[model samples]
Target: MINVVIADDQTLVRAGFRSILDGEEDISVVAEAADGAEAVERAASERPDVVLMDIRMPGVDGLEATRRIAADPRLGDVRVVILTTFDLDEYVYSALRAGASGFLVKDTEPMELIHAVRVAARGDSLLAPAVTRRLIAEFVDRIKEPPPAPRLNSLTEREREVLAGVAAGLSNEELAERLVVSIATAKTHVSRVLTKLGARDRAQLVVIAYESGTVRPGWLS
Candidate 1:
């Protein structure tokens, strides 16, 4: 089972999430918190597999708490899924940079919510294809340059190519077709690129690739 913690400032939100998750056979709500500080404290103790977090909260807030949880090695690979009503790019940017494994609007369907949790638990990502494109367009509109190049020293040329393709929102299947390889092989390359770049997931890879100048904005369109 995927052990989870629900952290939000509103009791109703927490209760609602708890209700949605409790019905899933593959998941269990191990704990719940109403504020970021309490969420951090509980996270240290409970060490859940995933945290469903709200970005806006009283004290510390979800973003900072997520940073703390993500930075601490003692958390032992606990992943976070930013579950919030707001889909502000800043929140998404901070969350992805902080190593959150998933991002979803709170109004997301119950099934999607559950899937997001499962994806986080498995160390996969929930940055959908459409979200990826939207993220790129949003970033492009805000800045002339991508964030900043990630420190990539040892990556192979092939890995770099795969990284660029990913920045264009190419799914693994699409990547396979483009690279003339099997889907599994494409996934392997993508995973290796992520590991080399210290990216949390494909979304982070895309951001890093664009911002770092690994992939140019010219190619995005």
Candidate 2:
């Protein structure tokens, strides 16, 4: 089962999420918290497979809580999915950088919310294909220039190419077609790239791709 902890300051929101998730046989609502500090405590104690964290909260805030949970090696398997009412790019980027596996708009459909949790639990990034380009564009708009390149000495040329495609929001299937390889091979390449780069997940790979200039905004469109 995919164990989860719901962390939101609003009582209604937590209840609503619990109601939606409890209906799923494969998922369980292991705990709930009303604030960021409580969320962090619950994470340390319950160590749920996934954390549904609200970005805005009283005291500590979800961002900080996510950072704390992510930084702790003991909670390495615990993934966080940021919940926000707003789709601000800054929040999205910050959450991802802070090690959130994914995020969802608060009004996301019940099924999508469930899917996101499952995706996080499965160790895949929650960034949907349709939003990937938009996310990269927003990152570009926010930064005047690319940051310094990350140390990519360990990557093979094919791995670098695969990394670029991932930054472009290409799914494993799409990447397979683009590289004329089987989907499993593409996925393996992606996995290898992530391992070499020390990325927490695909979202961080996207961030590194942009920051390291492996993929640039102008390269799109």
Candidate 3:
């Protein structure tokens, strides 16, 4: 089963998510927290596979909670997915940097929400291509000079292309089409890039791509 923890300050919000997620046979809402501190505590104790976290909470807030969870070696398997009212919420990038696997809008369709939980449970990021490009580009624009990514030097030319494609928000299938290779080959390339970068998932890879200047804002556009 895919264990999940719903963390939102509002009671109704948590209940709503629990209701939607509990309906899934493969998913279980193991715990619920009304604030970030409680969320972190629950994460440390429950060790849920996925955390549906709200950005704005009474105390430690989702970003800090995600950072705490990401920093904890014991919770390495835990993935935090931020819940926000807006897709482009200013704090979303910060949350991602703090090790959140992804973000979901509060009004996301029930089916999409379920799918996101499943994706996170499978250790994949829930970054839709168009939204990811726009979001990452917006944040990258503010960085006058991104720090160099020395680790990128270890990647092969093809691996670099795969990284760029990932930062551009291309799925494996799309990447295969773009590179004129089989989908399995595209997956292999992405896996190699991830291994080299030591990224936890594609979401962190996107952050590394932007922060390291491997893929710049508007370059894909």
Candidate 4:
């Protein structure tokens, strides 16, 4: 089963998510928290596969909680997905940087919520193309000179392309179509890139691509 912890300040929000997720045979709502601190505590104890975290909480807040969870070696397998009222929330990017696998809008469809949990459990991100474009537009300018990535030279030409596609938030199938390769081949390339870079998942790949200057703001256009 894909165990999950729902961390939102609203009781009804938690109940709604729990109801939708628990309805799935493959998923289980293991725990719920009304704030970030409790969320982190529950995560550490339950070690769920995913945490549906809210960005704004009373105390530690989702951003800090996410950072704490990400930093904890014991919780390495835990993936945090931020919940926000707006898709373009200012803190979403920061949450991603804090090691969240992705973000879901509060009003996301029930099916989408289920999909997001499944995706994160399998160590993938939920960076939709439109959301990615908006995220880039909103924060690209804030990225000053990217830090050096000495390991970037380790990538082959094709791997470089894969990394760029990931930075642009392309799914494996989409990437395969763009590269004119089979989906399996695209998956292999992405796996190779992740392995070479020691990235946890596609989310980290996005961060690495941007920070390494392999992909720039307008490159997706």
Candidate 5:
């Protein structure tokens, strides 16, 4: 089973999420925290596979908690998925930069929430096309023009292709099938792309791809 931790300040919200996730046979809500600091502590203690972290908690906010978790050497394998009220641009950018696996709206459908948990547990991201556009718009709205393209030439042509696929919202399994390679090989390519790009997560890669013009806006559809 995929171990999960639910971190939300609202008691009712936590209860709702627990009710939804607890029913999943492949996953379990191993712990719950009412604030960011508690969330961090619980995460350190439980070492869950995924953390459903809510933003705007008292004391340390979820963004800071996410940053702290990402920086932890012991919790490197734990995937953080930020749960917020809306797809606010700043929150999206900050969450991705803070090493979160995804930004999710709190009212997300039950099945989608379950799927997101599974995706994050596997060390990947989950972003709908609309949400990704909102994220890119944060940079676009601030700069008014594209930043100079990031130098990703350290990657071979194949690796770049793989990155493009990832930016297009293809999973590693889908990419392997498309590229006619083993799933393990596809995963390696993704790892190399993230490392060479100095990206902490795939959500950032998608942002870079669009913001850098390597992948056009809304290309994932």
Candidate 6:
């Protein structure tokens, strides 16, 4: 079963999420928290497979809580899906940088939210094409981009291609078709790229692909 923790300051939101998730046979709502600090604590204690974290919360806030959880070796199996009412670029960028595996607008459809948790649990990012375009637009000022990660140098040419495809929000199947290779080859390239770049998942790979100049706003579809 996919264990989940819902963290939001609003009581109604927590109840709503729990209600939706509890109906799924393969998923379980293991815990709920009203604040970021509590969310972090619950995550550490419950060790849920996925955390639906609110971007804005009292005390530490979701960004910091995500950072703490992501940084903890003990919680390495945990994946955080940032839940927020705002679709601001800053929030999207910050959440990913803070180690969020995915981001969802608070009003996301119930099924989408459920699917997001499953995607994150499988170590895949929930990136949509529109989301990728907006993300790249927000960081187009490449001059002020983050410092280059040395690990980026470790990627082979094919891996770099895979990284760019990932930043473009292509799934493994799409990537395979684009490269004219088998899906297994595409998956292998993605795995190698993640390892070489030291990225936790495709979300971080997207970040590095942009920051390293492998992908750009103008190039996005």
Each prediction's RMSD to truth: 2.5, 1.7, 1.6, 1.9, 2.4, 1.6
Clashing pairs in 6: none
lDDT of 2 at 115: 90
Among the numbered candidates, top TM-score falls to 6
Q: Write the per-residue lDDT of candidate 4 for residues 10-129, one digit (tens) a residue.
A: 999999999999999999999999999999999999999999999999988999999999999899899999999988887888888778898899999999999999999998898764
Q: Score residue 1 of candidate 3 by CA lDDT.
A: 98
Which stretches of model 4 miss by more than 4 angstroms? 180-182
As for TM-score, the candidate ahead, 2 or 4, is: 2
Q: Each model's TM-score?
A: 0.86, 0.92, 0.93, 0.90, 0.86, 0.94
**Lowest-lDDT window of 10 residues in candidate 1?**
141-150
Supply the TM-score for candidate 3: 0.93
Candidate closest to the true structure, highest lDDT: 3
What is the per-residue lDDT of model 1 for residues 56-144, given as tens digits with 9 covering 90 to 100? 98878889888888888898468888876766556766777786765888898898888888877886666554664565556555666
Q: Please list the C-alpha lDDT of all candidates, in the order they appear.
A: 0.79, 0.86, 0.90, 0.89, 0.83, 0.86
Ten residues in a row with the worst lDDT in model 5? Answer: 136-145
By the lDDT metric, which is better: model 3 or model 5? Answer: 3
lDDT of 5 by residue, 86-194 (tens): 7774765777777888878888899999998998898778855566655665554565466786577687989878878877778888899989999999999999899
At residue 153, give the lDDT of candidate 5.
65
For model 2, the superposed segments whose C-alpha errors exceed 4 Å read 218-221
- Candidate 5 residue pairs in clash (backbone atoms < 3 Å): none
Candidate 2 residue lDDT tens string, 1-221: 99999999999999999999999999999999998899989999998999999988988999999999988989988999989886755776788888888788899999999999998998888766456556656766667776666568689899999988887777899899999999999999999998888888887888788777787776765
- Model 3 residue 80 CA deviation (Å) reads 0.9
